[model samples]
Target: MSSENDWNEDLCGCMNDGGTCLYGFCCTPCLFGANAEKISEKNCCLMCCLYLVLGSVYLCWVPHYFERQKLREKYNLKSNPSCGDCPTTLLCSPCALCQEARELKARESVQRSALKANNNQPVVSQPEANSGEADHVNMRV
Candidate 1:
């Protein structure tokens, strides 16, 4: 609650001589005025160090963070790749097994389809022989 006048008076008394206060807080102009430019230089150096450290942190984190974010946006909602919907049988559909099985299945299905198509052809009919000559003679008469 001290007034400005009292503060100024204290400052003036502390600076009456060229000497500084016992605690080194007050002087003719200022206790730190002699080294003001040095203080500013040190602050600038500290700011540069802070900026360098922060830049390094940001640079190191950017690629991984962006890649992870992209992956999350791309595949986050998908089902587990390790688990499939349909049950895995001895011979799975669209199976990840060897190519031989798939090729064999394809060949078998093609052969079966070809067989079915061949069997679907129309049959040729022929006339039957008469059991007796009388029947033939009666028909002729």
Candidate 2:
């Protein structure tokens, strides 16, 4: 790892998340496309098709390589390879995709928890607000 932050999760740590790992393993194309879509790549289906076709020829690593680089750039993460992400994607495509999915999942949960925490607290100290309905808008009926 360089001065940049390491990836929050390990590549082989894919087993830590069963559903995502299974998804990455069984539907590698979908996983790749989805990861690309999350990082703002347009045409998720196109990406899926690309992965399908390229993967058949064992060249899917090409797109995954660039996608990984984009992800690294997006999050300021350190690339593990001195040669860059190419080798990692070339050698460990499934693990790479699983890692991406887990990263997205983990970040999403963290964000949701953060929002929940924030919503639970008041931004400023203030008197309780009263609904005037209790006083002037009463109906005796």
Candidate 3:
């Protein structure tokens, strides 16, 4: 192979000529062609993208599995992806929207409790009584 014919074994899997690989399209053939560098670069780029997506899925989503029991014990977090938008199963950050929603719900619950407490109280109409007395006094004047 020439110095410019550097091909990635992983990218193409096995390439016979200087063309694209039949098995692994991400790999470049390193046998001939002046565009060997470009082809190799393209192959490397494809491999990089593949690795990136795989890594993202594995690292981001897979970790939650490893900590499945622990998360469940701690936060009642389960690993069921079908558990309807819970943070433990989701790959996205839960502290953003989920936490915000939980906080908002808690706030609304507190407000509701406060409203219930206020409703339980007996409201006195001192202003109305005072206004009626003022009107009566004005009539006398």
Candidate 4:
């Protein structure tokens, strides 16, 4: 990991992005699902189902905590001393989800702008075609 980068926004800065804040506030499960999909690069439906199921038993924070860790690692963000991932996700899930979504959006914007500046091409993050499956073929002559 490289030097730690501060979060682009604060946890309670949901109002910064009204759309994301509304989604997270109105439909928490959906928000969690979307964030999980981006963070884990897994099936969106599967992640949504898992979040809904575990949320019933108050265990949704488990996966969310891991996702937060992943975000920290990817951005090389320092851990919050006052409120770690587990506590934040467990206690204030909506805020946490909103923060993660905002961070992802900001990162994507930065990437797109950089690409555009370098070349007049629009580059977007595409999902992996193989979905992590090994590509192999058996050839018999």
Candidate 5:
């Protein structure tokens, strides 16, 4: 789990980022599933289907709520006021999904930058003994 925090962006900020919001809005199921997959490493197709299927009953928020809660726990995000997870997901699923997508994007960017920084860093090799081998072996593909 990550450290305690609030959502990177508010749920209502769905349109704040531009085309990602548009993509999320246009493909709500896909966004929901992809966001869920990012949080749980589960098959996005299942998530997508869940949204499409359960959506008819207007209760797609059931699974979405659970996934949102899991996302909060995974990210150590403080639940929105008044036990906001279920409400946010339930009341406006698209907005919730968009928020989750933004969060995932932010996380991915952070990870990419960190990985790139590590790759750019000079590797400090330990002094090699007479074992005919270096202490560390780094092979870049």
Candidate 6:
């Protein structure tokens, strides 16, 4: 039901979401950990530790590349001919991680909205007023 020729956001669109941009800039390991967790449906701490430890040895990119490829395939994303997972993950690790995080975040939000709509629930609930009357009640003398 999804197209395989497009990415939800451009690689350079890291600043589109301030929170994600900040997290990616300040703590990339944490961002990657969160992304990996979301993608694998695993524990965030475990993913974070794995990334941090293996990433230090330079072989971590292998796993990251595979994960990125998996995400692209799962989401029906267009493959980057010039800059595939290897180069993207190895050369520009932060940017690649940011892009993946953005994609996952967008996908989750879209799914949530779709589910809410399908359930016939308002996206935002309105508070009910008591007594169906104005707040200005007159006191009888």
The TM-score, computed over Cα atoms with residue i paired to residue i, of candidate 5 is 0.83
Clashing pairs in 5: none
The lDDT, on a scale of 0 to 1, for candidate 2 is 0.86
lDDT of 6 at 104: 92
Query: The CA-based lDDT of model 1 is what?
Result: 0.32
lDDT of 2 by residue, 85-129 (tens): 787899889998998888878777898999999999977976755
**Cα TM-score of candidate 4:** 0.81
Candidate 6, 44-78: lDDT as tens digits? 77777877888889766776787788888778789
Candidate No. with top lDDT: 4
Ranking by lDDT: 4, 2, 5, 6, 3, 1
- The segments of candidate 1 whose C-alpha lies over 4 angstroms from its true place after superposition are 1-97, 125-127, 132-141
lDDT of 4 by residue, 58-87 (tens): 998888888889988888887888998889
Candidate lDDT values, in order = 0.32, 0.86, 0.35, 0.87, 0.84, 0.81
TM-score of candidate 3 versus the correct structure, residues matched by position? 0.27
Off by over 4 Å in 4: 120-141
Worst 10 residues of 4 by lDDT: 132-141
Stretches off by above 4 angstroms in model 5 are 1-3, 131-141
Best by TM-score: 5
- lDDT per residue for candidate 3 within 18-134, as digits (tens), equals 223321233211111112212222354443444346456554223223333332333343233434333532443222222222333344577799999999999887555678788
Candidate 2 wrong stretches, greater than 4 Å: 1-3, 81-83, 123-141
TM-score of each: 0.22, 0.77, 0.27, 0.81, 0.83, 0.77
Clashing pairs in 6: none
Deviation in Å, model 2, residue 110 alpha carbon: 1.3
